[model samples]
Target chain A: MHTDVVHNEQSMTPHPAGSARHPQAGGRSPRRMTPARRREHLINTALRLYSQQSLEDVSIDDIVTTADVSRALFYRYFTNIRDVHVAALSTVVDELIGRLTLPPDGDFRQQLHHTLAEFVTFVETYATSYTALLRSGSTIATSTTDTLVDRVRDHVVDLFRERLGHSSSSPMLERTLRGWIAVVETTLLSWLQHTDLPREQLETWLTDQLLAMITTTAQHDPTAAEQIRHLLAESGDEP
Target chain B: MHTDVVHNEQSMTPHPAGSARHPQAGGRSPRRMTPARRREHLINTALRLYSQQSLEDVSIDDIVTTADVSRALFYRYFTNIRDVHVAALSTVVDELIGRLTLPPDGDFRQQLHHTLAEFVTFVETYATSYTALLRSGSTIATSTTDTLVDRVRDHVVDLFRERLGHSSSSPMLERTLRGWIAVVETTLLSWLQHTDLPREQLETWLTDQLLAMITTTAQHDPTAAEQIRHLLAESGDEP
Candidate 1:
């Protein structure tokens, strides 16, 4: 499980221009851009490398070489590899949250289905980094990175609450929602590793898992049953 | 979220004999014990300290002083604090696995309830260290420690498989079980932080949560439906 792929750092030979490693390859030309644009470019370079491999495998040298910038410039923008990793992951979290909006006027099932689809697409897009960011005991694991992951989970829970139109959820309802969220995360992590089932099946199964949790919770807690009765009614799920 | 309660390391004063910190306290008298016994003593000392606070808060000095041993002796038995922490947690994992046995001749629901009761008891006994071990990105988090945590999860899954009498489970059944296991973990972690619900309710809700997952999976996968038919039937659950 601790198989961190270490790229060869002894070799100083840069990839040829236009190669896959250096997508925006240039022949050592003095291309000029504003400081903000340059910082974003560096972050983008780090993200592209993260896409190919775990954050533990990417290094400062890799980032600078791929960005076609000096080590000094890289340090000037970000203090270390972890700094850039956090910034890049924060960007990913922002993109994910921005893409997860429900229109608030559709059937509950359809809205949940669409939201889960978008979430799945985001996870697929950032598979490697998503795995690295969530995997416990990674060398690059930090409090900030963990907080970013929590932010995503909290966002999903808040979205669920908003859709249910409840000012405050009963304890049973909250725990049921949180428990379902954990199931989704663990299932997605496993799916990313094996992908034994089709993506649509995974999506639909996760949706069903949440509804199942809510239904089961309702059986035990009258408050939850009362609060989510309308939810079951709206979705035509007689539980 | 990263509030690691650091103890005052500068205070080298050891607790009085027979105090809580040193259950086997002695008044500076050289005690005789075998090498294996000595190592076990050190491990127990770490566990005692862990029960009082998170692993992050306990230090080498704390362990040595509490155990009534010199720093040199502490080093002789273990490499460092993390070495002792890992050994202590492995002891916990062993105890948890040993206690989670299900009688092979009882009703499935009763068996599950008994096993979950034992699990809840163990978690309550080792609340602080269990939380620390499962929390992501802790300062003391290591691949070895993380593997110990995984060992517990794998043991639980194996127990389920044995009880289900399946030589090999279908993909849907395995995934459903794993996802429910995650829910149990997350729900317990939250429950530990806030004891808002009764312990019996927690155990029963978790049992129902697994049944719910299995039932929902059955609706989508015929293989799972066929595999768990006897399980649901024996438990007198229509779904």
Candidate 2:
């Protein structure tokens, strides 16, 4: 039905699994969806609820009702609200990672700008989902398995490792990378609250912040400093 | 009475307000001399509890019972557990701020070393309180007032300003500083999770991470960067 389409594309949050227009956006009759489609439909609906409320505050009924699916349909995919939350978060993280790609050719600063530009736009679009996810404190209830935040963090760590591909591993390097990620994260988190600041400015600041942490870390740990400098030399884009 | 002192000084977290060695460590004769002393006593007790639990998880009855203070006596200083939490957090924040004394005389990096060395030691002693307070997410519940984390953050911001005491204000500067604080905080939070890392190494990494962020920010925001460089020039400790 067009109602489901409109509901799905409600500008609050669109179900990622469904087609952009939902084919049913213009009509009022509900369409029959396969099991996979139903799961995506439920997730997109749950994401909307999550964007509006904290993870603990949303309900299974809220998700089912929003998706226009019956409780029986909802139960087919998820055993509890926690599973839905975890899946919804996974979708967001996947979407975030999928959208990002970094070019290895350019000044490190320029490379940073290219990556952050994409990230900022993403943040602009899903500011609500991003907020709720961080407010979840990088975790989910009822499960100790890796959450979306953990996966995102790993992706970042991997990206940094790839960038510095030749450098030998050390605790200092690990700590520095983790510290830089925290800076980038908190910087973006606070930036979402103050959108008055230009996205261009936020990008530049974040790029610079990461660079600064590296130099600062280098000051105290000579071996790390040397190893990082060597990596930068090999990269052909040393700052 | 001695059992109370033993319980309080169990070393998971001792009162930051008290000397590292509680003069009353040898034997406990619940010394109740004045209202000020009693408030400190209660806060110290609450901190030990909080180290083991979270801010929201602790209760007034838990605190009063632990301190062996009657409910009537507890009522004299605080109206709720929230107030006690805020006050106790302030005490820890004050102790943290007090130990740090950055001389305007050295290289900025060296000064950072001095400041962070003190911070790391403070963190080591009060790891639990530091974790709980930050896990409180830097804002107390049930009120919109400043939390201890806020005060500590402000202190770092102020310290950054004084270090670049002569630089003019810019949004870039502001963001960069906040970014550094986030790095410091998240770095410390994660460090607590992996305590086998030497304290000296942690301090070095944090200091380097902060310095790197400032430099990186300068690279992107040239005006602020130039102003910062000029300030360092004036400080006679340019690297």
Residues A81-152, model 2: lDDT tens digits? 878877877777788787666686886667667877887776666666666555423334222223556677
Q: Give the chain A TM-score for each candidate.
A: 0.86, 0.76
TM-score of 2: 0.73
Query: B11-105 in candidate 2: lDDT tens per residue?
Result: 32345434564554344436454566677778877876765666567789987777666798889999987788778777777777877778767
TM agreement with the true structure for every prediction: 0.89, 0.73
Clashing pairs in 2: A1-A29, A2-A25, A2-A27, A208-B216, A212-B212, A212-B213, A213-B212, A213-B213, A216-B208, A217-B208
- Candidate 2 chain B, run of 10 with poorest lDDT: B136-145
Model 1, B1-239: lDDT tens digits are 32333222222222222346443555441355557667777777787787777878999999888777789888988998889888888877877787788876777788888888888887887788878877888887778888987887888778877876887778888889888877888888999999999999889999988888899999999988888888888888767
User: Which candidate number has the best DockQ?
Assistant: 1
Candidate 1 residues lying further than 4 Å off, grouped into runs, are A1-30, B1-23, B26-30
**CAPRI quality band, candidate 2:** acceptable
Model 1 CAPRI rating: medium
